[model samples]
Target: MKYLILGAGPAGLTFANMLLSSGEDDFLVIEKENSAGGLCRSCMVDGSPFDIGGGHFLDVRDPDVTKFVFGFLHEDEWDRYERDSRIDLYGDIIGSPIEANIWQLPDKKQERFLHHIAEAGCNRGEPMPEKFTDWIEWKLGLAIAEDYMLPYNRKMFGEDLDSLGTYWLEKLPNVSYEETKRSCAEHRPYGTQPGHAKFFYPHSYGYGEAFIRMASALGDRIHYNEPVFSIDYDNRIVNGKYSADKIIVTIPWTGVREHIGLPGKLTDSIGKLRYSSVVIEYVPENMDTKAHWIYYPDPKLSYHRILVRHNFCPGSKGYWTETNLTRFDEDKAAEEGRTYFVNEYAYPLNTIGKQELMKELLEYTASKNIYGLGRWGEWQHYNSDVVIRRAMELSIN
Candidate 1:
């Protein structure tokens, strides 16, 4: 059967590669942008490389996905480094993967956290809280929760904390009262597993190089700058133009439904889905530092996070041949007088009712031949590795 995949991000590319490698050659990958690697793409600016979509790291533990993607790279092509992330709260730098590094907090804050942990430990057998505030309070305690977690989450999601589901805690590390206090007293920050903190980065090119490599492997199967305006679901085709036996869509669900002229019920459900828009301001080389990623939990900051590109890939320096780098709004940027670029995204904002709405839309869409995957299409948040793994699973089968 012929397959038509939409959006050239990790999800679409993974599906395309899997199908082609399995001897299923009759497939096409469509991307709206002029190139692949959607938000993960990187560009040169004033002799430095900056990833438009924050910093994406490949630290997946899944062997199947890792072997398939990185198998092509030579040993020297990849650089494995431990994650050195931090949260910039006011002027203090707190060790990141935030929960594990609570000891970095001031003595008063530390004591408050310990008390909450102790209370939580005693109440471990009770039912977990449903709201985000309760989850943070229960997990980190009211003091830390109110001070950092809640405010940071609000800034990130652009919504209230109570709306979010507590399920994400599974990916986080939970510490007991004794452990937290001991770590604080000893001045030893709680460290996560080495594997979790370590990631494989391309030594020479930016992370986008990985996608470019994947596209190169596909030969003539990939198409760029092809914005699919419509899809004929009844006819099982794309743009009411290209005929295909099966369709795998990875674009925003709202856009997909608009193309197909979905019914009111479906349209209404899709409309309820909310998303956050990101602006990635790329600064000059001098601004680049050793920070892999910095989190701004403070609500005062307009941007949620800032990433340093030069630190991630030193080889990117060569690509910075141009003295002038493009800015998002030249007029405004000129006012500021700096070389920087920004990448914006309408990513699904997980609200209280969003999950349920997405579930309904996903169920409705799945009944059709089209398979929806990835962040916007699935209406769920996922890392690059997770997106690729899911796409691979769909394509391999």
Candidate 2:
């Protein structure tokens, strides 16, 4: 069967890579962008490479997946470094996974946090949470939930925590009482999001280099700047010309639904899927910080996180900061002569009923021999590893 792959991002390219390895030549990939690497792509900012769509760190725990990804480049193509992430809370810069590093706070702040932790049982077993907010409180207690998780999530997700479900809570670390106490007492690092303690990046180019290399290997199989005009699934026609027996799509559902019409209820359900956009400000001068990225939970700060690009690559002279706001104040950026890029769809939210709706949508698509892949198409808050794994799994199948 001739297969049609949609989008040439990591997911699409990885899937295509598998197809190519299997000697499958009939398949074709169509991408709206001229270049590969969807949100993971990076660009040059004044001779220095900077990530235009926030941070994309490579830290796959799966050995097989790691082998597959790193196989694309020579051993010397990438550089490895331990994660140097921190949080800026109440003007204090502390280790990340803030729950495990609260002891680093001042004496008064530590006492207050400890009292709250003790009262709330230090993230022990509790009833299942109904909303994302409840899940945070249950895992880290009211002190952390209010001080960081609640407000920070509100800022990051661009919605009330009560409205979002516990779909993505599994990503957050859930340290036990003993571990939490030990971390605080010893002032030792603890409870990092597993597999993120260390990561690798390209020594040259940017995070997107690997994907670009893969696309280069694929050559003419990918059609660039070819926006899909429509999809007539019943007749298996794409853009009124290309026809396929099976189709793999990596574009957003919002984009898909417009082309392939959906029923009112399904459309409405898919519409409920919310996303938080990002604005990245690329400062010309470097920020004097050793930490790679610092979370700004205080509402006082307009931006949420500041990512020092130089920390990842010494050649990179400056940093990039992200804000949830879409319409960036270009005037402010121009004053500092900082260039900024805005992405309208960055992080997808698992709003309440999202799981059920996504299930329904996928089932319907599968029935039509249409499969969805990637973060936006799948509408999950998946990391790069998860995205690559899904592509690998689909390729062999």
Candidate 3:
């Protein structure tokens, strides 16, 4: 069957790659931007490469996904490194997988924190938590929920804890009391951390270079700068020009439903989905940070995380920091002598009832032979690896 893919990002590219491997050639990839990569796209400032969308790292735990991604780049084209990630909390640099390193806090505070966790462990039979706030307290106890989880998430999400869903917890690691005590006693933290403990980065070009290479493999299949303003679902035509028997959309879900003229019920469900925009600040490469990225849990700071890009690859020539904000003042950043790039829809919100709504939307679209793909397209918070794997799974099924 003829196929139309709405984006050339990771998900779209992965799906297209799968089709090519299967000898399915009747397909086209339509990208709105002048290039590929979607949110993972790259840009340059002052001759320094910066991932303006935020820091993109390869730390996926899935072996198949790893092999697939690495197939696009040569061995010499990339380098591997252990994660030098830390958190800047209360002006102290704590090893990341924060829960595992909580012992680094002051002795008095650590005792109190462990006491709360002990209490929480004693009450393990409590009912399941429905909201994000309750889930944090239930999982990590009141102390961690108050000191770290609540405020940090509030800043990142730009919303109250109660308004969000607990599914985003998948991105976080869960540490137990025994794990923490052992880590503390041994003076070595993060023994049980999942992915990101070790990762890889490209030796040349921007983070989007991998996706660009994948697009290059397809040769003339991708049509860049083709902004799809409207999609006629009834006739299965995009912008009144391209027609296909099946359409796979990797674009953000917000505009697609309206463009296709879906009914009010589905539109209402689409409207409830929320997103967080990001502002990436460019700084000197020599910034005083040995860590690849540092998380700021303090509410006083405007930015939640600062990524030291140079640390990831010493030849990159600069650093980029990311923060979620409703509004980013360019003048203020300029006044502070900083250059920045704003990326709208940098993160997907897992607000209450979001899972159900996304399921309903996917089902309705699938019935019409239209599939949603990727982080934004699926309206879920998925990492790059998961996005590619999902695309491959969809192509096969």
Task: Name the runs in model 3 displaced over 4 angstroms.
Answer: 121-124, 170-175, 334-337
Instruction: Return the candidate ranking by lDDT, descending.
Output: 3, 2, 1
TM-score, model 1 to reference: 0.86
lDDT value for model 3 = 0.80
Off by over 4 Å in 2: 121-126, 171-175, 257-264, 330-337
The residue ranges of model 1 lying beyond 4 angstroms of the native Cα positions read: 119-127, 160-163, 191-196, 257-263, 285-290, 315-331, 337-342
Kindly give the stretch of ten consecutive residues in candidate 1 with the minimal lDDT sum: 318-327
Give lDDT tens digits, candidate 3, residues 1-397.
3999999989999999999999999999999888888877777776756786888887757878888888897656777878878878777678886777877887777777777776663246677578778888888888888878787887788856688877767555544677767766676765576567777778766678888889999999999999777776666788879999999988887755345656668778878888889998887757787888888878888788888877876566567777775546777888998888788778888888888998998888788788889897798778788899999899999
Q: Work out the TM-score per prediction.
A: 0.86, 0.93, 0.92
Error of 3 at 139 (Å): 1.6
Best by lDDT: 3
Clash count of each predicted structure: 4, 0, 0
The alpha-carbon RMSD values of the candidates against the true structure, listed in the order shown, are: 4.3, 2.3, 2.3
Candidate 1 clashes between residue pairs 3 or more apart in a chain or in different chains: 47-320, 230-239, 274-349, 275-349
